[model samples]
Target: MPSSKPAFFFSSTQSVDNRLGDVFSFIWGSYAGLRELWWQVRGFNTQFPDLHISEIENKFLAGLPMPGGIDFKKLFVKTDWAEHEKDFSRWILFDVCTLYEGWAEKVCKDLFSSSTYERNAKAIQFPSGVRANRQVSGYPVAVNEANTSASTLMKDEFLPTLKKSYLNCWSFIDQHLLAYRFFKECRNSFIHSEGVVTQDIIDKHTELATIQAVKPSPFRNNFILPSQTLGQSIELNLKDCINFATIVRKLICTFDAALSVAMASEAILEQRIRNLVSNNPKWNNLPSDPAKREQRVHRMLAASRIPEPQNFANMMAWMQSKGII
Candidate 1:
């Protein structure tokens, strides 16, 4: 019941390792694009004559030719140029508008729709597929659909499961969300406008300084620094987003582990009671007094080797009766 399966940190470690590569590329690519864009956007009138389109694009392009053949699909999922800046012309501003508000909406949608992420996709269900009739095209269509699907996924699958896990890890959730929101706001400001992003802004908006003030966790909390900020110009990069995405995936896995363990523990308890009922045959009508039943369970658990919590017996019984175990 305590999970014979190994800790998810193995998967987490591998995921983080792969994610770091994406994040690193994203950061470098984003910064290159941001630097180029800044000169064009802010220096358009003054430097337009000197700016070369190919040079600017090439500077940030990272020499990774437009993905083709077998690598296209994988590359798209790992990092998208449209979402990143090189494909600005292809980006649907309206769809970007939705993600600028919240990461959960987009992240959840990707989880559900991507066949490649089958484990996550299977978690979401379509309720009658009523919206299936709608037909749309273009980047806007895809983005809008993704948003809708993500919202449904969050409501039907993520929210209920996450809430249950959150009960066990509320403090972590709160701090993470705070940091996420800060990143979102700061990211939007720099990406959307020519405004300068300063270290202070990143610190205050990201709450990195505030978080640093608090005691650190056993795990290294790698502080995220915005790549776009300069003394006078803001540079946009994709690394931060990828890193944040990596963090979200880790959180989901962590929650899944906890949920599985909790379910397994209850299952073990339920089986124990059922075995008792079948073996003794008199367990069904043994006692009607709730107080006495609780006391019996308390004493039995106390005598056992495992140090269970006070309400564990009641929880186990409830799960058994509901067949949830």
Candidate 2:
């Protein structure tokens, strides 16, 4: 059954939004502290003058409890400071990219969790082109659709669905979407290909130009650039890590705010569609197919001496708004 009451896009993201801000604040603040530690280790010789950082730490730090009686010195001494520098940047890239992908997955889940989206998804006739891979053994068709859609978000051309559903908010951040996709490509390359931009990723990087172009550092004069040479690994510093991490963090929060504001209006608009379908005799007179229904609806609007909306969703919302439903 279709959702009876007007409910969608989450009943309230207020708690989620507030806590998200706090969480990111803690994360980036701690990241700053970690960053300082990185610098302190790098300049250890200059500050200590006599003792190496590994020497001081290894002598006294060994007294701490160890689950496996592991030597703490090995971690610092296994690789020189210069080697540690490269590893730090690569680790940060992997860590933040993982965070971004995880958060986006959660967002996808949340967006399609509503009863409205569930009913709408079920209505989709499967064995059709819209990613209907779920087996119908146990779960309902709608459940399968919703699951497939959420899981596939941002991996395929899933952003367009979000843009249509959350039109105004998505349109506002149009350029941000491009940038987000660009970073996602970088993340894929690093994670799947050992930090070397692959041949497939090269065409995408060339098209997006995000990795190809040099980015300015927020905290220093030094720049972050990914080497475009296809087979070689690129250099990534702390500044490079900071740039992507901060942008992804901001983009998520900004998108949440946008969703919160526009959801109620969109909910009302969606409800209007349900109302027209269930309550109106004119709707029953039309064929069950959407194209035929829309053509009939367009004609009805013209015959009523009213203007037709550009899309079926808009048409239904328009009719309700005009007191014609």
Judging by TM-score against the true structure, name the best candidate.
Answer: 2
- Candidate 1 at residue 40, lDDT? 48
* TM-score of every prediction relative to native: 0.31, 0.44
**Per-residue CA lDDT of candidate 1, range 235-265, in tens?**
3344444445544444444333322222223
Cα lDDT of candidate 2 equals 0.46
Task: Kindly report which residue stretches of model 1 are placed more than 4 angstroms away from their true locations once superposed.
Answer: 1-169, 194-203, 217-219, 224-232, 235-243, 253-325
Could you tell me which residue pairs clash in candidate 2?
none
- Cα lDDT, all candidates: 0.40, 0.46
Which residue runs of candidate 2 sit more than 4 Å off their true CA positions? 1-58, 68-74, 113-175, 204-223, 261-325
